[model samples]
Target chain A: MSNKSLIVTLLATTLLSGPAFAEDVTLTIESWRNDDLTLWQDKIIPAFEASHPGIKVKFTPSAPAEYNAVLNSKLDAGSAGDLITCRPFDASLALYDAGHLADVSGLENMSNFSDVAKSAWQTDDGSATFCVPMASVIHGFIYNKEAFEEVGVEVPQTETEFFAALDKFKEDGSYIPLAMGTNDQWEAATMGYNNIGPNYWKGEEGRLALIKGEQKLTDDQWVAPYRTLAKWSDYLGDGYEAQTYPDSQNLFTLGRAAIYPAGSWEITGFNAQADFEMGAFKPPVQNEGDTCYISDHTDIAIGLNAKSENADAAKTFLNWVGSEEFATIYANALPGFFSLSSFDVAMEDPLAQEFVSWRGECESTIRSTYQILSRGTPNLENETWGASVAAIKGTKSAEDLGKELQDGLASWYEPQQ
Target chain B: MKSPRIKSHVIVFLAPAVLVYTAIMIFPLFNTLRLALYTEADQVRMFVGLENFRTLFGDPRWSESFWNALANNFWFFVIHMLVQNPIGIALAAILSHPRLRFAAFYRSAIFVPTILSFVIVGFAWKLILSPIWGIAPDLLSAVGLKSLFAPWLGKEEYALTTLALISVWQFVGIPMMLIYAALLSIPEEVLEAGEVDGITGMAAFWKIKLPLILPSIGIISILTFVGNFNAFDLIYTAQGALAGPDFSTDILGTFMYRTFFGFQLQLGDPHMGSAIATAMFGIILVGVCIYLFGIQTRLKRYQF
Candidate 1:
């Protein structure tokens, strides 16, 4: 080959490689629901790329349960993504404490959100901020409105009426009163134990007592929820343990279950069904004196991994999530209750608007239970609460369950110092 | 003396496999074992001797779960022993039938599930058995056994069994193929000779074929035992580490995972997790030793 031809080819190759140097940043953002939220990646991310010009955002998703596992492994290896999604509660406090999370303390638009949301988003007792709440979710019983109407039951306002309505549905043979999936243990704990039990336990006080080790999980006060759950189990379809979240959801949507106790995250999935017009309501207390409690967790949040190679780009992305542009897209496409401070996205879905209005009353009395119960309580669910489910099923007695939970949690709570 | 070239030749021939094995297997194995002898406080690891083991076996919090999972793991192993190997053996024997049509198709069809990722299988099974969907009920009703249709996966009484059956369904083909290879290795002259001696059909299978294939069956059983004891993928994919419906399906592998990586309530403790891993390794080692020395020794093979 001639030297001139070779020099020309090399020059062309170097010019092509120059753009690669300019577009040097690849920010990996990992979440559990990239497939579920395909719109965000296809539309919103491209919009960001068009505006930003030189940065590329690679969306990495892991399987639901394995997401956290993979994330933790990455963190341990010091190779975590630039942006990560986490549900910020008591469980996530350890990640914050370990210095694995970047503090997005002074990010713009932090002042606009509610104090409760900001507090919820913070990791180090509100001093350090780790994540920005991408979406807020509320947990309540989502009833099939048509199913309830067929059974001549109104939304139960009190605990007595709730149980009566459930019984009435059971008597009519129209549908199972409550369709619960236990394939995920946390489902039971979320709907059965954390939601209703806390209401019966006198709300936040009861949770605090458990957290402080002042109240034993075996105490007689705890028996009511177990008995209530045992009764609730009678209405669950046979082979319910094998049933997963989506399966149980199909029960409610298909008109097999009158009441499906789940979170508002299920609303979109429910709305897609042709068989039912879904409605959301809080579970009624067994007694009039009992305050209604709603169980909840942040559906998703954006946090910067402390080990990110590109912290500036990660910060910019997080800032956009909290910005009005991102929130508008999220609210319009996703239809979740956006927790941001200043967004003029009109309340589009009538059903979702009703939930938003009701959420005001719900959050007023809303208290966190699982956080206190879960924090520092090792094997408490598996050995105690899980055994309780089996015990209530007549595999073991209630007394045996009480003893098992009491003994298991004693070591967990006993002074380690 | 042997030539100096002989020593160099041996090293050259064996070097690649030995180096690869040492890097991948021996190093990680020892590292995991070494990690078991440490404790973590505020993210810093400290040497803790056997305290982690003591905590695993002695502390009420860890001991009960550890023991329960160990028991469940044994039951899981038992199910494989009772179901997988026998079905595999039967299918292998039948497929080894030279008269059978489309043997390759049957073999391939049955073996398809073994290639599926446990995540896919777990979700697929979860959807198929969901009572709300009514597919399971429809199938059962068609079989004239609709009354037997119940939520099998959700009930604590039946969760483990259902999961075991699902696992066995997926894995039976492995043993089937292994034993099929072994059965084909047996010469046609022995079977023809058996037929000539008036030992034919079921009798020939029982008297002559079964004895020769005993070693293959033994190997399959040992493999099943080891696989079942180490089983985690399906349960983890389906139920998470907590193995819910109140931990009814908690097995040793899941328990080990929960210990290693903290879930909603528990903090991750690598020391305890490593100890559990060590315990699992020991159990598997003991089982392998027993199979090697005991079952393998008793199963005599006469070359045909």
Candidate 2:
């Protein structure tokens, strides 16, 4: 046989063998959704894998409390999964800044996200998108509808009315006016200060001004919110300091408290455990007729590891996550969290619906304390939270709390300058 | 050495353990110290000699939390020393008595909590002390001391002390067991000699037994010092990363963790975290040194 003819025969043989040689790519997705493992195992993964042939997704779950640290170690070791779930702001930004996150900006479904959601996963310069926005959580007071009706109190729209409602509950003396669990210091900041502080700060502009050093936390506007928080502390009832996050949730669910301020994440737990009818309301504004602000923050977003060997497969999965199809699946599976995508899903839960209704109705949605304080500033939340605890305990005045916040902010802001 | 050289098998047998120890313990220890000298800014890590340490000590924001945690840690140690050691010593004394009944059962029961996970112990105590649950309150009320139940774990003034006590309750068995073993090794002849010399019971223990067990007690004290200073899991499990009720229960371990990992709103600064860790290492080193030189040297171990 001629050499050319022999070579042609070998080439033809290799080409024919290619179909059998193709390997299924396995993409590992790391997440802190241990509680919702069933959702991923039963629904999300199967749906993704079904559509994308020759690709298998391996879900790696860790406890939420240890997820970031675990992810950090993995990333440092250059052994992180192909896909990673990151907390929005500092957590995602840190990875993005370190060039550990793959810039999936060219993903076709990026346009499906709103500007707010898009900005969350993007760099400060808006030059790179590190992750696909999955869900944004709403923070508000989860109240007992039965207790409100029994006391003939309308859902408060204003701070004055809110205080009056608390008085009504206090007068009834059968239930706690507000369930506050400051024992876990973050809870006070999360449920109390952050939920209420934004109403006084106006919105994103006010928060940005503070972040940019254009406004001091000790300013009258900022101080007013803390004062309001201090006043609200009065309605927490005796032994409120001793109350834990779970205890507060238990109190609200058991009809011991009229109102429980928390994030929408607790909806599923509340619904399953609560014996009485539960309703949610946006925290009241300073004035009777003023527009109230809702505390909205990104819950979880999917980021691709830049160092992943299966980058193409990871991007494919992330692009799918940004699609309307994935949004539907996500929304159906975790109905409590509001999807950040333009894709609309009907929320059947009344409490969740109430929060969704506030998306357009409320004056504005602002970042939660965790997001605001976590950016570039170290221990600001703890310091501010400590001050808030002191204010609630009547050990420190609201003015002192404001000053302390100002001092803490200056410590962070001055060093940067 | 010239007469007989070490065998190849000795080196072969020793290499695995030495390699394992160096990889797990010594390498990481030195690496953590090395990380302390570098600071990351805008995702770029730069070598900044002593800058992180200076910031930790001089910066009000870092220093304040550092000092508060340090102070609280000291108090935590003091509580264990004052309440835990004494109680453990007394329990060991009682249990080690020749005439004691159900000694085995009591020893096992007392040591049970020590074997349990810190997470379980912390959460268990948290629930037991919860005011809303009425477990602690009802118990207090039963004794007509309900007013005295002031939510000790929730109060800034009391949170650290309450947690310290809880830690003590869980770990008292450790010192008890160690001291008990030491007491059991007391030869009986020496104790009999004490009895004959008019040193009976309390006199025998205080004059004869305790002095002989001083070396063991010293070792236990140093162990307690190290354990208490390095405590994190209990506080983190119970009060959370914030170590809250306004960080009153914040200890060095929790502080280092929060600084290292960055909790809530704070970005994790590895350099700063490492500096804090290095500081902790120094503190531990100093403590170990003091025990070895200042305390351990004076504690004469008997030949018994």
Candidate 3:
């Protein structure tokens, strides 16, 4: 055929297929993950388009820190993406209350999600489901098996042994005992300090005390953890404060630090490195009396925009994300500990298996620091904690630090209480 | 007395821009301020008058945060004023020098960071400063100053100041270009006359060039004031919403975000957020006013 005739024929075919061929509607999925995950979107969306025959998915990524800022800005400006990853906190609740997120209860496959995940997505006002759960990222301390082995230390299971192992590692001078980079303030809690703090200082009883307001943040018990953190700080290489979040992780990966107190989401990135024998442990407890706690941070849990024009498409997407096929897809692409109750998909990473085991064995739940510290305390309390960490380390009395926290909490809790 | 056709044309010409500005900027800004006066209860909003503002400034929990961020925000602005604008002026003066080579390349290189998305700048800097991953230590080691490399972004004492300097580094090009353009616009004869009268080099810059660019400098200062107060993305991206190493880098923007969006446990209060926004707006307005009434009028425009 002549070039003109062939071009005309192709145009006619495209016209005949119309929106139905390309998945007529283009929907944007907003997430805070790195743009490197565009591969997932580019591949998955095409498959969905081909199978469903009418939906083109566009991925709109935001910086993880600025995710909320961007989401708020977009929602405020009334130009938010159709689908967005939502968190289980007041921030998400606020967005829901603002009438920015659409009610997604009527999605056909809502029943596939676990009860906890479902409740997490529900608005605080007992309103309709406004979001869908994606990957359930849980946080804990992960260590390099090779580094631990090289240093002749076994992964400490109990809290007492955890510190002992670190001490041993320190004595041997083979590895930096703990690979924690506290430069990122949130890691002090999320990956290490906060997750392990409640387990060690408060335990389940302490956690209960905190919830009931029987204990302020500066209780005498908090001293132990603060001291422990200070001890850990000594093992950190000189000029550790210069490290960023990714830097700290890289240290662990590069075997500069023996252990990284971080979340399970990091396993994929860590495992990708060659010759790393990595195992994750819930922040170790000092005694069996204490709870072996692992803080949960479900990564990229998705929800519908309350004002989404493509509510039906969003519903379909949410249900698909919760489906077994979706589970398999996620497992194949980005394998980690997800919060799906469906027994269909298996975990790929061994660290995830360890996380799953600890999660399964958990007897009680203490809300993570991100939840408590964020929810109970007003903003910038963490900032105060960062300064206070140094203060306490600098021969400042634990009592004084505790009192400061007590005073601080009193200021925050008094008004809200 | 205006003709109907002229009036219609004027309205038509301005309608789109005005509508968009109001809808996107002015209306939301006012709405945010209004939201500050209301509190959320069981997902429903309650009108609380000045309660939110009161909580923000008076309640210990809110007040501590507000004051810290406020103080930090002021410091952030002061740094920009002291470092960014002056440096920009200096660079602009140098770059605008007669027969300077590679001026375009230097200008472009300096402005590159400003055009980059906040994520790139935040992470890139974070990487550069990372003792574990960054080459800063390696580069420093080459110069025998590796001991100087510390995670500036992670330390409570250094985080804010470090980030401020980073911001100044990225944004200096803006004021530089602005002052440069303004400097170029000054009449050459005036400069020549100044030269003839014995004012030259540093004297010419300080006595002659500096006075002429006062209005532009004033504009840059106010812009800095407003921008610094409203700043979020850089700190948020580099520091996270928690603004940690224990919130050392917490500024008004991050504080406002945590309050408005509820990070973990604390419920987000829109009223409080709105109150914060209103406070920011008030602060910015006061700053602009001070510049307009107190400073700008005294800084003679030097039309010549």
Candidate 4:
């Protein structure tokens, strides 16, 4: 062939061959896990990429505080990533209602999730699955074991013993009984209200009843918990209101406080910096020998964007997320959080094993205030936090908080019957 | 004869500005006003007229927070007027003195905080004033004023005032620069004439310099009023959307944000958020109108 003809033939051949070569598909996954970027980059993405050739995963991480706003804006612009982080209840519901989340009901791994895990990421009608449940977080008190031993106080199992333990720490005068950071407001609710609120509400049934208007927040059952929170506030030490969430965590890690109530998500962080041995316990029950309810709610779940051009590839990524391999990687990367799947994954961290031990021993697992509050009105979460602060400061009585809660609920809650 | 035609250049120059302004500012303002008259229920939006306003002002749950925020907003503006403006004027007067050393350096140093983002300022102040951290307390103790130190940002009684002070500290440079420029524009001959008439230093500033800068002061006052009323970022960064310690630091901006966007457990109500915005707009409009008609007319501008 002539030189010109050969060059042209090579160009045409290459051009024609391009159609036969499979293009690499990039699935964008957005999460508000800026702190754990290394985990996703080094472990999760690499594992997924290795198993599935010709498919590349791009992870976009945002700060936790601004994640929801950023995600909403992306969804509104119809440019959200293929796989998105899904917050449980109202946040997930809103996206599902807007048809932004793909229905992955028929995925084979969907059957692996427990009913509780499935329900958390399910639509209101329970007819379709919108996300693959990833992990569940437990909330309770993380105590400084050395501080407890120094004060000669053992972990309490009931309300009376808990108070006695606080008194002992108070008498010691060196350590704060409860390292509460009320300045952030939500920390108080996350550490105290969610951990202890279920005791008075009587777990899931009572919360559901409250939602249905069968029970009022002002009812006698709630007064005890409110009063208990108020009493617990006294043990938080001086200038507790000025302490921030990170401040409280620091206090606990430094052994300045005996106990710090927080979620399982904090375990990985605490383990890295804590000088003292750390231990966690379920909040004590009100009545002696009564079973305690632990705050075990879905923490993070991955949803496929319904409008994504690469839905099939996204589904494949999500299916692998539900597999045993992904669960092992995820659970190990963040040690304390338990995987929602029924796969036999061994938890390596002793602290994580301590928390996981409660799963079988506790009377029941309950949702936090984030999940139980009515979705129709302005968020009751803030109101509850405000009430807790007010109760702590003696600005509002328990009865006053109860009435405030009822008024807040009355804004959007209607009687079901 | 044909009617006079406007020139193409006029249309071309005006079109871009007008189009940009309408798209960004005017359109959104009207749309928010329209949204205020509607309500959403179970995914359906319906016209509810002034019912949202009634709910905002009448329902005890909503009204309490609304009134609290409005009152707090007013106090925030008052603090800036009473504290920031006076300090700014004083600083400007001192810096305007002809023989003052390093005047440019001082001016730039004072203006530094104004350029910092609200998030940075909020968190920085939060850390500095934190009782647990002891930065402020330690400083006070070093000066033998430990007894005077308090958790100013955490207390309900002091949180709003502390935040207002922080904002004032950041923004006082704006008024200082404007007043300084006004002071600089005053004729040296006029001041020399004043000295011939036995006026000098403090007396000269009070009689001549202050009067000449009255127009600038008036402008600064209106700007501070508008800025304070619309303040949200600092409070949100420092206290969160709840604006807590019992919502003592809550203001119209935070209230509107929480209502419009919703927080944990609460679904957003755009209509109610719009109503709050409309309320804020009305307040700002009234303040601006009062300044334009009542205050500005009385403050005579002296063309030096």
Candidate 5:
């Protein structure tokens, strides 16, 4: 008799809650940018909600390094959020091919992004666009202004000058010359190799050529960067082999390190932690007259979950994500992340301004291994990470590392073969 | 009719436990083993039948990483066997002394790390050992031994060993406690007998206490083997998924995790992951079986 009453009570409660829940559509976003949680909740989501009263949005994020694993598991279990944050290149491309992410070509203001901006999320044949281009991070060095004065060095423009300044810092005895570590291996590659690489590769020309199999990694353009990276360890203070990403950041921000090999993404973070004034400089050119090329890598984008129940509301949210207003908000909220859109944003932060200003001064290219080249076994990105660390540590010669990368690529990547 | 009546009670009582076990343990174990035998081919899940194992063992890329992980895993285990166990046994011996004062304080202090989360232990040690801002350099410098310090966690040469020691520091308490309890449970009359025979202190421990606690020590050894093989969190927290300083610390668990779950830009292949898991299972099974069928039978278990 009590069982029947319990069943009736459950039915009644379900009926009551169902209608109330339906009154407002809540869309959850999966992202790896945990640092931007408060910014999203306070500004981005509230702004979106204010425009669309019936739709509510929640921004959920996991650790940056664990994001790929977390998102894949969640998607496999059918518990993914309505909106999915997208990594650049083959990683997100896999999700799109798997039908986990929906096409967003029909999204409002989709045309606002350039061909280059949408290049990361588009199908190989350039038929379908799956994610809205959000932001790109430029690679450079973030230096302490005070440290520069103490070391008696001006901002370096040439590779020779860069090394000279590093030598000066070393002689000064108070500061670490270059602040970067191989502990978290990606920082060693992302901030070290990829940052300085384009200066040798000639940016998009070499990257595109490498993709087409016209330029091998063994070529002078590619191997030259590794040769340069081998010298980086000497300036990286003693015991840098064990120093982590956070340690490097702390070293620079605490005014103990003169220059930090950086992605523009570090601006917001460095700004928060640092007390001393900071400045930004692009990767120093090998020659005085050489055209500088920056790694203006498209970092993150957002796409719709194909299996979302609130597809319409999610589409509405995605359309907003493509807009200039969203671009401005996101780019400014995270100063280091410049908008991928053609919309020229006036960044309030000076360090960010310095990074973005390079777009006009230099040719820009994404990381060489990020695109289709990394699709196979012995992933090129992973290979580059180890290779970079080895280069810095001088455990492997540049020639050997180049051959290893090529060999690994040839083992799987057909174009390289 | 009476037999049927008796069987019904057994079936009813056994049903819940049997069902739960099958769902959680038995099913997953079989499924993982089954998955090791299959793989995705042309977007279709098909029976590859030893293909994954062939690739794992024969292919240079797969085999190199596999062998490396296996070797590192052995080293990780050897460190525990050589260092952690001996330290634990020594601590247990010292603490078991009847004349020892503040034994409770020492026991609690030593055992505290064992109860702490792997994440806390990993990060805490990482911080303590950090060269940039860590206290380790400061502490060493204070003693004029600053030159003796190197970035232990960052160097490829020392990363695995340093991590092993940190792990030993965290988990030494487990074996210590087990051996302590085993030592305490030995009848006081036995010690009294040893006292009358000139077997006191070290001699008494070697002759009386050590032999009786051999079973417990055996159990602790097996437990350490299993725990070390299964370790992922501490390494993941301290080093990261790639187990860096150039994958120097990659063990079976991390390798399996990286293969199965993927990390960074590398895509996960569950079939390959399952194959690695199966390999790990085989290794562990061999260890456990040796302990159970060979070692355990030789060790004498005593009763009061």
Candidate 6:
């Protein structure tokens, strides 16, 4: 056969295969997780397509940084996909207010989620929900087990012991004491401040009080975390000032750093890269007998596009997402992202299991600067990022950082004023 | 007016360029300036004449960020002027020597960075300077100067200066090429006149070559001003949108972008962003006007 005829025959076969048994509905999902493209195509779509033979699903993602802008343009042009992956809090809430996202309240299995899980994507008064909660990441310390053993240190349960362990590792000089860096800014705020903060502030109590204007940032509970972070700088090692997020991750995984102040999302990546046995411990309590608290921050969710043509099929997929089966597959696939559904997912990764196990022992609350506190000018979340970095670098005193944050918050936030 | 047939022919010939420019450039510029005059209240865009500007200048929250960015931008331009252009002129002078060898090779090597993408240059420099994976410390240690190596990009005091130097390294080639062309264009007759006057070598270049290239220097300075004001990609790639270690490297372009499109948790406020953009346009306009009317008119563009 001639080469041209062979090409024509291949094209004809491809064309003929389509519409042979056309699916009734094809739903396209828009997400910022371009990393999960294969996970969606190979694991998620296939699982959904199996049970629902008449429906097909497609997963399309943009670069994480560009997703919001790309989605906004697509939505404005009425060209967006059927399903939209939601960011936690105000970003997604703005989309819902603009009528871009359909309310997914009373969705199938929505009852499985707690109010805290749903709060991130809900209305201010908690009367309406826009997105089905997907996952929450826990904050803690992921440590190198070999380094701990080699340095003759046990997992630190109190702030005093935590520092002692760090000193031991620092003294040995075989490894850097801590792997986290302040260059990226978010790690200082998220993994360092929020992780250890809940214990000081007593979790939801401090967070709620701050929202109600009952507690200012200058309050000892709020300011104390900054004081703790100042000491973190000492163990961050030489030339750590310029270290980025990926560089910190490499330092920890390469067994060059003893402890990494981390979010649960680091589990899968750390497991894949590290040859050393890894273990996680909850954020150290101030005292040995203190009640512990964890920042189990709700990070992501899924929502239906208000303009989706096939709402029924889209809902079917969304409903499936809120199911135990989907939750198990997702949670196990991405170890750190614990499903928000209350169906009791058993995380297969040991480090992930260690992180999730904290929920039973510690009081859980989301990051303090999230929710309504971050909605105004001098956004508390962004402000916290700077304040935390300053705190860790010892550039600003804890009391001064607190005052600066409080002043910024009071300028616009009504309750704070 | 011309004859109807001639005018129609003229219109037909000019239509595409006119329409394309209006659609892309003129319209957007006007629209952005118009947007600066409005504020979004309850999702309604209402005309509030000069209110946004007042807020930008008088409101400490906005003004602090604005002034910081503006100051950083000036420093960035100064670095380019003080370091990049002078070095460029020196290089062009050296390379322009009558007996210089491998001149073309040297020229191409320096110009290579100018053609490279900003993202690649930013990331490459980031890795090269990185303490952990980088060989910078090793290289310094090889010379017994390891203690001198600090994380230049991470320190707030040094970040903007470090970034400015990186930008200079990338763009010094442009000024070099421009000044080199200007030097090459000076007629051989002028050099003969200089030789006759006993003004050969350094004296010949300083007295003869330097004066002829003054206009080129003026043009390069203005181009540097405009380019520096509009720079966003390098800082955005290296320092990120926040332009940290506490926004030390934040320039007008990054400031406008952050306000216009938002960062992590901050939502976009187009009106405020437009106001920043309009301010930038005004600054550039004043700079260009100063170059054109005040400076350019005074520059002695001598005839051959």
Best by lDDT: 6
lDDT (10s digit) by residue, model 2, range B78-136: 99999999899999999998899999999999999999999999888988988888588
Compute fnat per model. 0.73, 0.67, 0.66, 0.57, 0.75, 0.55
Query: DockQ for all models, in order?
Result: 0.53, 0.61, 0.37, 0.62, 0.65, 0.72
By DockQ, the best candidate is: 6
Candidate 2 clashes: the total is 1
User: What lDDT score goes with residue A108 in model 6?
Assistant: 70
Model 4 whole-model lDDT (C-alpha atoms): 0.85
Q: Which of 2 and 6 is ahead in lDDT?
A: 6
lDDT of 2 by residue, A335-374 (tens): 6788899878776778788887888877555563444454
- List the lowest-lDDT window of 10 residues for candidate 4 chain A: A363-372
TM of chain B vs. native, candidate 2: 0.97
Winning model by TM-score: 6
Return whichever of 2 and 6 wins on DockQ: 6
iRMSD of all candidate structures: 2.9, 2.0, 3.8, 1.9, 1.1, 1.0
Q: Where is model 3 more than 4 Å wrong at Cα? A: A1-86, A89-140, A158-160, A171-174, A201-205, A213-223, A287-335, A338-348, A359-417, B1-17, B95-117, B181-207, B261-267, B301-303
Task: Give lDDT tens digits, candidate 4, residues A51-126.
Answer: 9987899999888877777787798799889899888777887888878898888899999998888877787678
Candidate 2 whole-model C-alpha lDDT, 0 to 1: 0.84
Q: What's the residue-level lDDT of A19 in candidate 1?
A: 83
Sorted on lDDT, best first, the list reads: 6, 5, 4, 2, 1, 3
The Cα local distance difference test for each model comes to 0.75, 0.84, 0.73, 0.85, 0.91, 0.92
Q: What is the TM-score of chain A alone in each candidate?
A: 0.84, 0.90, 0.87, 0.93, 0.95, 0.94
lDDT accuracy of residue B252 in candidate 6: 98
Model 1 whole-model lDDT (C-alpha atoms): 0.75
Off by over 4 Å in 5: A1-21, B1-7
- TM-score winner between candidates 1 and 2: 2
Could you tell me which 10 consecutive residues in candidate 6 chain A have the lowest summed lDDT?
A15-24
Ranking by DockQ: 6, 5, 4, 2, 1, 3
Estimate, for each residue in B99-191, the C-alpha lDDT of model 1 and write its tens digit: 999999999999999999998998888778877564888899999998998777767678888899999999999999999999899888998
lDDT of 3 by residue, B186-300 (tens): 8889989988999999999999889888899989999999899999999988877777766668898998887776554445556777788798889989999999999988877
Clashing pairs in 4: A379-B266
Candidate 1 lDDT tens digits, A233-347: 7777766766667778777878888888776666676777736777777767666655555544444677888888899988888887888777777766665444544555576
Error of 4 at A118 (Å): 1.8
Model 3: docking quality category: acceptable
